[model samples]
Target chain A: MSSVSFKDFRTSAARAIADVRLQSAIDGATLTFRTGRVKALADLPDVDGLRDQLKAIRSATLARLADHLEMFEQQARAAGSHVYWARDAAEANRFVLDIAQQHGAKLAVKSKSMATEEIHLNAELQNAGITPVETDLGEWIIQLAGEPPSHIIGPALHKTREQVAELFSREVGRTLPPDDIPMLTAEARRLLREQFLAADIGISGANIGVAETGSVVLVTNEGNGRLVTSAPPVHIAIMGIEKIAPTWDDAAVWLALLARSSTGQPMSCYTTAITGPARDGDPDGPREVYIVLLDNGRADLVGSDYDEILQCIRCGACLNACPVYQEVGGHSYGVPYSGPVGAVLMPLLYGLAENEALPHASSLCGACLDVCPARIDLPRLLLKLRAEEVREHMLTPQERLLENAVAFVLRHPRLYRALTGLGRIFQRPLARGGLLRLPRRLNPAGERQLPALAKRSFRSMWNEIKDGQL
Target chain B: MITARDDILKRSKQRARAAGDHPPAWRSRRQFDDLSRRFVDSLAAVHGEACVVPSLEAAFARLGDLLAEIGAGRVVVNDEPPFSGVDMAARWPDIEWHVAGRSAGDLRAFCAAADVGLSSADAALAETGTLVVTSGPGRSRLVTLLVSVHIALVPVSRLTADLFTWTAGRSTPPPAMITLISGPSKTADIEQVMAIGVHGPKRFIVILYGDED
Candidate 1:
């Protein structure tokens, strides 16, 4: 993943906030998802109990993830699947490319897989002279526009109907109406169907890798996942080492909560579990199956402070519930994973120094925890990352100086009171209706005014009451 | 140089924490007074069609009616249990029948060009209105996936309370592939607007019938 600096986040977030079309699209999509999630969870008999059960399952699985992964590899090999372990993205991408090259594949169809996005596999495929077609409608839209996904579940939620129509019109070399969403969707289906049939290889990500049966579970509302895994002669699935379930029973619970939290569905339209390639008598299915287990810094996080992030099923419920994500949209995070999860995961995966701004992206609001099916304490993780940043001296010298000075004044109540009294007098010229209308050049809080100092201090009122001078 | 697998395993082991006790199995309290009614209502909520009939003969008649109602000329059927040994071509002589794995022509080609794909569910979940289908000797995965419309004949006896009940009761090894389909293929990808039949069946129909005594 390319490193997005703090400056980049500021620039892009400002641009996203100013884009009216993008703002409305994000708002409408997130609001609908939030409302749907509430209704769906309300229907559950014991949602809190289910969430606790899920958290236990995930934490326990992670506690001995290596054992489960080894068991999975053994079972998958028994089922005739070739399992390859990749230490990082380069190795994973190289393995996939080698498979494509060995098969002389020209076109590779892919389902929506964040693991692939994390490894930047499409560009590698393109560079190797193979065409990678994203089969998911949302992923395809972003792929066409040459942009990263703004949201995990709804990749094109930042786009309006008019923008999508424009992109589709360009692709087909014809004029298309923006309002006719069905026609647009039908056109995509007609076009992608050919790619599914003609593609020589298929690639996907596993939502859950069951250790007991050596199965890779894929949950999708569209049938692209089914086609991508079924049509091609060779299928490759890349997954993080942490996406493992110890048993079929455990996977069932994971599946029960995954769709409900992600899209408010009782179950996704298609939940296909591929154990291996087609059986002997099976007339049609993939001929070869390859499972690439990607470590990619995930193993190092096992016992770390951020290990709970590995429990994320990537349902993206936190993304829908985050206030910062709702305002700036997902592109500001500048990663495949976005929202609160991205804010914490990116910094940990990449480095604290590299993704400094992301840890501070949140207002520390605990909405993500409330909606998380796994009940990951995202706010606590963010705080930990921030503290790590401070401990490691990731902050700039100026920031460090400012923080120290503020700390000093806060420690000295007399100085703090004197400064506040002076601040009130100095703010008389700029103060207007409880806000300080500072000049644009002098204002650091752009587009928003800072709250003015109160007319009198609380200490002054306390002293007045104490002296019976109300 | 160490192998990626060996290195990853070493690192994971080095950082491994003590394994916590496994949580107890979750038993769902979701029970329906009428499984068939809940099945129909739940399926209908997701824009799927379901009807409970009296017997296998009625179910077959309903399937024929659906094929005729859609004016489907080409139909593909999976040669699985209950569907096997049933000569669909003779029963529906007007429709072009392609029995997967037993049919002479290419199954993929037949399904791709077919108007409706038909199969029998291995099991059904009433809570979510899901049909569980597995791929094996006579069952083809594409039979229910590639076509525009998919119709399944499910015995009411196969219906369970939900996924919890289904998984807990399984005694046999899973097949090469197992799919739990809850509704017709749909997407809300573009501008968050719902559109049906993106890559799979536009309409999913379930015919539930009483088990033969």
Candidate 2:
């Protein structure tokens, strides 16, 4: 939404890495989520079995997503909800704007939704002269700070308590203590409650869309998800096309694993299933319900080599387990979805040209694959994206030439050995304590040093040993 | 537009893997011998309180004590079975009482302003200490959501083994809304520190009655 180029990643990541407070926040938050996920899964009985079952369901549903989408549209319409299809972000935002304008809506309350963020709905609404109030605590903080979410689940994990207190105090026009978290929470609750009561429309993101029941299930620990869906006269749920779970049984498996993977809870405090608007005899809930299905380049990936990326549930476990994410933090990704999932999906969804650097952000450590509840092979996807980038000539000219030279050397063993021997002889002056310290301008790795080539080539040593010569 | 829908479906049909048979059946097994005991212990683990009573009369007696202890001056109760027969207005004559679906005042506002909201749990899961309440004619969604403290009366017969079992036994068509509440509303958004009572009820108390004295 903010329009960032991958070329800026190095600068942005360096800035983020240099912030001590940010490093502390990132380290503390990710460690907590990682350890909590481990303990929560270990406490459950047959956690792996449930994950396997969920994966099977996800794969099966994706294979027949079109049929499931038809069923969902039919069932949702039968249950009195209007279903709309948006080919891209603009169409989706236009539908939401039309609904808000039709009702003369002035203020709209939003629950935390990565779909909404992905569509850049807030800026669109603001430009349209309608105020969109984010109700999630972390989201609200970042909204007030005029920044995008830094984490998929915790939108403001980048902000410290002192920073939050400062933000809240500015809003309340009074100084509040930084250490009093409960007081800050109460202040936020009191402030958002007014917006909830007076808003004309509510917008949310669906965690899962059930085709058989025509229900959209949302899971949240805070009650904002419920309030956003319940308090307003009209409610709109924007969901990715890949979020379909065809049956109630499939939904049960998702519910079982979603909270456990994301927040390490047996279940989030609330798991709400809304089939449609308030029924005939219901006293509360929105009168109008709409679900906007957003395609936005995902359909192209449906049958592509990376279709398994569709199985991702946005649990943020991969983010917590990612080494790159832990070091550079989420803001460096420049998208709402970050870490291993971002490295793969950002290029696939946005385009490889814009995010060519993202695929290289990982070390292919495979830690993300180990923690993913959906078991998405993020490392494999990253490698595939990198290969595509190279094949498409997306690399810089210098990089292309370097790659060509390396390939040429690798093909001819004699040239490689001769060059290495020459490099060992030529690098005596630049080699400092076995590390090649290149100037910042020439060094592609920036601050990091390269290990100097071995003084004696391995091939020569192997040959000498085979000949019984020391 | 229909064209967008058609295009998306076309791409999906062309690209998606062949659909497999319906997913393997839900196979979660409940380990606890006494589901009610397991439910109580599970509920306690999530900062919720649960008590077992012999009959509806005993539960009502305990309910009265809880109301007095909470100093509930204003209360909202759902007009569903069991709760509909409690005669809350007559029992607590002085409190501003509102019964959902049968009250004179605005039910949503009353639930929001009331100190305690009461409802009957249609069913519950013992494994996760979850209470499933569906929105229908008499059950208002806000009764348990908007109050400071929520008290639900559960019958032991309505307890299920877990979510898997609950879905396996679900026979009727799905309601307009089904809420599965496991604990009091909570958030860890601020520095990943757990905070309670962000928007929903702060205290969740369940009265599991009508079996095994």
Q: Pick the candidate with the highest lDDT.
A: 1
Measured with DockQ on alpha carbons, how good is candidate 1? Answer: 0.85
**What lDDT does the true structure give each of the candidates?**
0.91, 0.88
The TM-score measured for candidate 1 stands at: 0.98
lDDT of 2 by residue, B46-146 (tens): 88889889898889999999999999999988888788776788888878898888888787778778899999887899988899988888888888888
Q: Who wins the DockQ comparison? A: 1
Per-residue alpha-carbon lDDT of candidate 2 for residues A1-470, written as tens digits (9 for 90 to 100)? 43335567787777787788998899999999888888778877888888888889989889899999999999999999999999899999999999999999999999999999999999999999999999999999999999988889888999999999999999999999999888899899889988988899999999999999789998888888888888898999999999999888888998888888877888888999888999999878899999999999888888799999999999999999998998888887877778899888887888888877788889899999999998889999999999998889888899899999999999998898888889999898888898988876555445677899888878889999999998
Candidate 2 error regions (>4 Å): A1-6, A425-438, A442-470
- Provide interface RMSD per model, one decimal: 0.9, 1.1
Q: How close is candidate 2 to the true structure, as a TM-score?
A: 0.96
